[model samples]
Target: MRKIPIAETLIEKMLFIFTVAGSLVIFFVIFYIFSNGLPVLKASGLSFFTTGGWDGQFTSAWTAAPGQEIWRFGAVELIAGTLLTTGGALLVAGLLGMGCAVFLAEFCPPRLRRPVEACVRLLAGIPPVIYGVVGYTTVVPLVQSLISDQLALEMVRICVLDGTSLLAGIMVLGIMITPIFVILATDALETVPLAYKAASLALGVSHWRTIVKIMIPVARRGILAGGIMAAGMAAGEFIAMAMVAGGVAFLPNPAHGLLFFLEPVRTLAANVFINSEVLGKANMESALFACASVILFICIIFSLLAQLINRPNLKGGRSR
Candidate 1:
């Protein structure tokens, strides 16, 4: 091999070191959280995950006094809240973002594309706190007003006493993740071989039909990968969910039907964040670490799903 430049060799070594360091950091964090959290989960037993309420006192020691009952720490409601908000966000973001991506990639005029893409980038750059503020000030009031109508409230059997609710959290998270989907899905669509489009047009297929039938199918894997990433983001969201999720750890009653979305809730990520200040309480801190561990598990699952969806076939191409 030709002699590599000294600068190039140094840069390559630096990159290798950085990659290893980053991976080590991630592994270290996972190890730390699990090591600290698993004991608490074991001590709490099944009730830790199955029970609905969270009642913990700040005891400097690990055990309670001789006549004092142990505090209860449960995550059933938090888990439900996380699933509801994340699933709802995915539904809303997937539909809206995929539509926008398809439009931008296939139909938008060249003149408007730049501006629209810029707008998407701007939206993506906005901080989560700003989204929370907007949801608290705008969406919360809007939902409250809509549910305040006696007929509508009665029809849905609205249980939310205030505007902050699962619906509000879902809406905020949906908006937050939409830009990610739009960017990723747009890129995926744009990457479809130009020959595919040319062949479809030559076959006399309409542009829309070709897109719907050919392009989308071909790009489904990428779209799904984007969705997995968006799901991870929504699942891990804290500030925005905290602001609009009503800070209540209560499972939405499925019997309420559509009004189930009106229930106030709290998510695992938000729970960890909300309870982070109680690190001095041994059991409580361990429980929060357990919550973080659960979040980590969720992220790992999403990552694995994305990897599986993007895995290549034996034919040396991405799986369909």
Candidate 2:
């Protein structure tokens, strides 16, 4: 063997060191959050999640302020709110994005692809605050006008059901994440070989059937991966949702149904931002960290799910 090149060895060692360092950093961060958060969880007990009345526990301070003796850390309402907005986003984006992907993959003319692709990229690049502003002005008004007065009054017992509600947040979140789903879905579909499409068509299958039976089957993993990624994106979004969701942590009132989406709600990310700014709670720091941990847990789950669906062994609907 010839002598090893100095540049190659040096570069390899340097990259290896960098990769290990990056991994260590992420590991330490997760470890730190769990270490700090578990004690608070234990002290707070299960009631921290089950009971309502957040102010009752957080209003009192052990140091700077004094009012109550107990600390309330109930996050059930936040969990509910997060799920509602994210679920709504999934519903909206799933239909719209998947439809767009199909249109682009199977029907779009070459001349139009550039413009449409540019628009998708632009949508992805826009700042979350810009979406927040646009939703607050446009979607909010649209929703307010669409709901019947009778339904609004019925929901008022639980929340304002006004311009700023879960519906607005859902719409805003859906629009914000649509580009992500479309891009991923498009990429997934693009991976299928043209020969597969031609073969299916030659077999006397309709163009529609070829896509449904062949292309879609090969691309399902990617499509699912896109959805999971979109869910994760929706989960992490706080600014746009905070603007649209009314930033209220109230649970659905007993009279309100479990599936109520017409009322105001708050997500875990929004709650963390708001509660961290609160001055009354003595354990505010710990509680905020716990909120962060909860979000991290959700993101990790989505990441794992996306990975599981898009494995390298299943090469874009083709078997090696």
Candidate 3:
């Protein structure tokens, strides 16, 4: 091999420096969020995770220090709502999207794959805000009508929640994320070695069995990574969820749960959006930052959990 020219080497080194600089900007931003966020966290203590209360006025009346109560926004409800909606969305998106991916990858004709892939990509490109609008106008009304009729028949004590319920948020998020799962899974399935399929077929194994026992096992990490990405996307959703999540604060009850499908629920992202209007107010501002910090922590935890779950499969991929 010929040695690189000094100028070319220097140019490559400069490109890497630029990339590192960009990465450090993001790293420092996260550090700043954690730093500004830590003081409130320390002051709030464990109660931050336990208590659902967020009334700073009530906190101030009993305070020893002025401006101290600004740190009192407990993030439990926001955290809970965020998890519930994101989990619900992931469950729906994973089942539907992965199944569709499997079919497209394993069963569909090669002639049909290109068009189908393009359609899925098109769906994925639709903005999250549009999904929210659809959920608000279409999904919420449908849910309310069905829920009202069902509650009338099944339970006497039913209270109808407006359309901004957790269920609505989940449904919107699921639809929004389905295309991602399909795209990722389809790519993964395509990457599976054809020799594996041929060997299983030669052994007289059913196609379904081969897919279940061999192909899926091998592609598990990719599928899992797709699922985790979908969940992360759902958690970060703001515009569409903001439109349909109703932005209410409370731990949902099973009894009132159906109402969650109809009523509005606040997510961490939505809280940040709604509260930003009062950003100049010290308590409200700090509270929004606290919520942001908690959201970041939750996202980090979820990502770690996904990696841990997929560790074996990821290792298997490396070995192969």
TM-score of each: 0.90, 0.89, 0.87
lDDT of 2 by residue, 1-320 (tens): 89999999999999999999999999999988766666557677886667655544455433334454344477787877787788889989988998898889889999998899999999999999999999999998987786778877776665677778887889999999999999988888888889989998888999988888888888888888888888998897888888888888877553656335567788888877766665334366676676678788999999898777767776555211
Best by TM-score: 1
Full-model lDDT for every candidate: 0.83, 0.79, 0.76
> What is the C-alpha lDDT profile of model 1 across 1-320, one tens digit per residue?
89999999999999999999999999999999988888677877788778866633323223576555344467888888888999999999998999999999988999999999999989988999999999999998877775756645464443444778888999999999999989988988887888998999999999999998888888888888888999999999999998998887778888977677777899999888876787866667788887788888999999999888887762211322
Predicted structure with the largest lDDT when compared to the true one: 1
Best-to-worst order by TM-score is: 1, 2, 3
Which pairs clash in model 2? Answer: 57-72, 218-317
Model 2: CA > 4 A from native: 61-72, 147-157, 253-259, 279-282, 312-320
Question: Please, what are the lDDT tens digits per residue for candidate 3 over residues 1-320?
Answer: 99999999999999999999999998998897777767667778888778875534324534537655455557777788888889999999988997899989889898998898899999999988788878899987766666555554553343235556777888888999999989987777766789988999999999999998888887777777788878888888888877887675656766654454554567888878766666665555666777778888877877897777567534432111
For candidate 3, the 10 contiguous residues with the lowest summed lDDT are 311-320
Model 3: lDDT of residue 202: 99
lDDT measured at residue 264 in model 1 versus the true structure, 0 to 100: 86
